[model samples]
Target: MRARNQLLDTDEPGRTVLTRHLPLPALHPVDYARGHAQFEARSDQRRRIVGWLDARLAEHPAEAPLSVLSVGCGTGAVDAPLAAAAAGRAVPGAVVRWTGIDPHGPSAAAFDAAVRHAAPDAEVVARACTFEALDTSDRFDVVTFVHSLYYVPDVLAALRRAVAMLSPGGRLLVLHAPLGALNELAATLAPETDGHPQWWSDTVIAELAGMGLRVHVEELDAEVDLTGCDSADRALLDFTVQAELTDEARPAVLEALRAAARPGGGLRLPHPVTAFTVRPR
Candidate 1:
């Protein structure tokens, strides 16, 4: 029996379908960097988020250090980049203290390493704990869930939790994908996985609004280049969509990908990311 990490069971059919269909392996940071460019075109959301944080910090003339809480911070992927961006945009005397929480032990360890490498002077704390079970009394200036909300069993509850952790005038930033062509393809290939189930951008926005939180959304246009990618790269891309096609369905999946390919080279997949900022009313 495979081990279960808190609420996520790695051996479950929905989560392990890709492992059954492909040679799953731990991806390096470089692989992920390319993967980001493959599906998403730019980092507009990240820039906008950092810029907003910069302005928020500026509002506090005291130059007090900022505190950030990042849920499901996988290897500090978003955390590191965000810290770097915030540093560049921060005014004098601005210091950011980041706390990352993730259930995966290895990911937490990697988060520590990545954060240190990215921002040598920043204070970063990595904790291995599920978001639902996290026990902390500290509030934060910013709370973010970047492409990590789906892992939570209760998306609404998770949002509520994050919102409750926000300090006065703090912002809750959530970056999630809309129901787009790429997700549609994944659903087509792995209907059993429920890959895109009930967690699209619209649902999140509606949920926040229902809770009386003011929300604003920004959509980022993204594209991926698969021109020179090898079979491994293709497999990695498929994994992004949570698609695990059987031998019979593999042909159809490939055909659909080809249909979405750009005229020149690579696939012109639709990667529309929505960034929502929630503020208490």
Candidate 2:
């Protein structure tokens, strides 16, 4: 199920609102650290994503000098590895460039910094703006929206724009771990209703293919161990909740979060991710 008409007026003129309702938990440092750690420890997922790109690039050897745009590239954890992989490829001086965009002020800065540290020779551009605000006429060899599609206000429109930015034979990749088991558990345990629109998967792919783009959808089984965490991290967890709720509703949501946390340390959480890849037709 896709979200309805929830567009906001942006400071930039003619820019469409990316998201109508923000999730309660605003992006935070702890979450960033946690995500970075996860990526570092679980390099296999990153390897898989890169391997998919390698196959695609190999199929189109004529399309050299890969230009990649990573939408919502939080902290550059994923981009660093991707850049390194591109650099190590056989294509010397192949011009591997990366542009990362994120609305979160600190995240954008941190990602840019990390990119510099991890891949010094790679050209990395970090923009602190909503994806909708990007108005580049140039196309890229690859465009990725990783784990950040759900936050966008208009999923279809965003997908359309991402596809438009892709050069011929270029690919657009969207990676996300939807609220599957987590949503179910949250719904069963909490009073506040939590449900995602079906359009998230079904409509997204249909719309992309309808545009004549070659689309591929892959659902991968993955799990994250959140065990041994206690209420002390309530404040950190609250940031995510606050992103989607009104300020007044935050306290109550925090209480719910506290209830959800395990007493000793952490809560075992299930993670399932879907990756959608599309080539411009």
Candidate 3:
């Protein structure tokens, strides 16, 4: 308890409390960052995204600078790696214009901090706004919604915006979790306010297809680490469910998490993420 309290109290400037409890939003960006750091699988996601980026960059002629926009760019964990890759030999003589957006102010600040260090050479801009309010006339060569479409008010509209904001021959990459066991637990424990099933890969795909966009999908396996996790630790559960929960609801949630544990039957979750790639000409 002391340790947890200590962590929450030390918020830097520009820090604010998390008010939205839709698809697993923490009350504090710092708390979200803590939970995010616990997931080793995100490292895998980062590697996969960076590898795909390098491949895409290779295909380009280096005719113009590469522009990348990251929607819901949290704390810069995923973008920093991609920025580093963009700065590498993938596209010689091509600069990477990095633009990131997140409604959370602190997360945006953290993103700017991370990007400054990771890809200092890249032209980076971090904004505290959602894609809907991006207010940008610039088009991007690559726009990514890495694990961020869940909380949007309208998933379909966001997808359309992502597609519309793309430069000619640009690609839109979306990494989202499917309807997995962990989400089922969350759905049972804390139903979303959206009055619909959470937006999984299928939801996004259906929307994209309706818009006549060509899309391809890839399955990526991951796990939500509840190792040494305390259900009493509200931040972890908040991130897991992407929402706020009552103390009364914690036990059932914790039990469900424990059931998915490994050989020891501890608190481990089997989380599979799907990657959606769309290239619109």
Q: After superposition, how far is residue 125 of candidate 2 from its true place, in Å?
A: 1.3
The residue-level lDDT of candidate 1 at 68 comes to 86
Writing each residue's lDDT as its tens digit, candidate 1 over 47-165 gives 55445444544453335677889888877766787676565555577787888998777788888888878877678899988898899999998888877786676778999999999
Q: What C-alpha lDDT, on a 0 to 100 scale, does residue 108 get in candidate 1?
A: 82
* Global local distance difference test of model 1: 0.65
Score each candidate by Cα lDDT: 0.65, 0.60, 0.70
Give the top-scoring candidate (TM-score).
Answer: 3
* Pairs clashing within candidate 1: 38-224, 41-222, 41-223
Tens-digit per-residue lDDT, 207-234, candidate 3: 8878877788888765555766562455
Worst 10 residues of 1 by lDDT: 1-10
lDDT of 2 by residue, 136-186 (tens): 787888888876776566677888888888888788888765545343322
Off by over 4 Å in 3: 1-33, 39-64, 90-92, 191-197, 262-265
Model 1 RMSD in angstroms: 7.9
The TM-score, computed over Cα atoms with residue i paired to residue i, of candidate 3 is 0.80
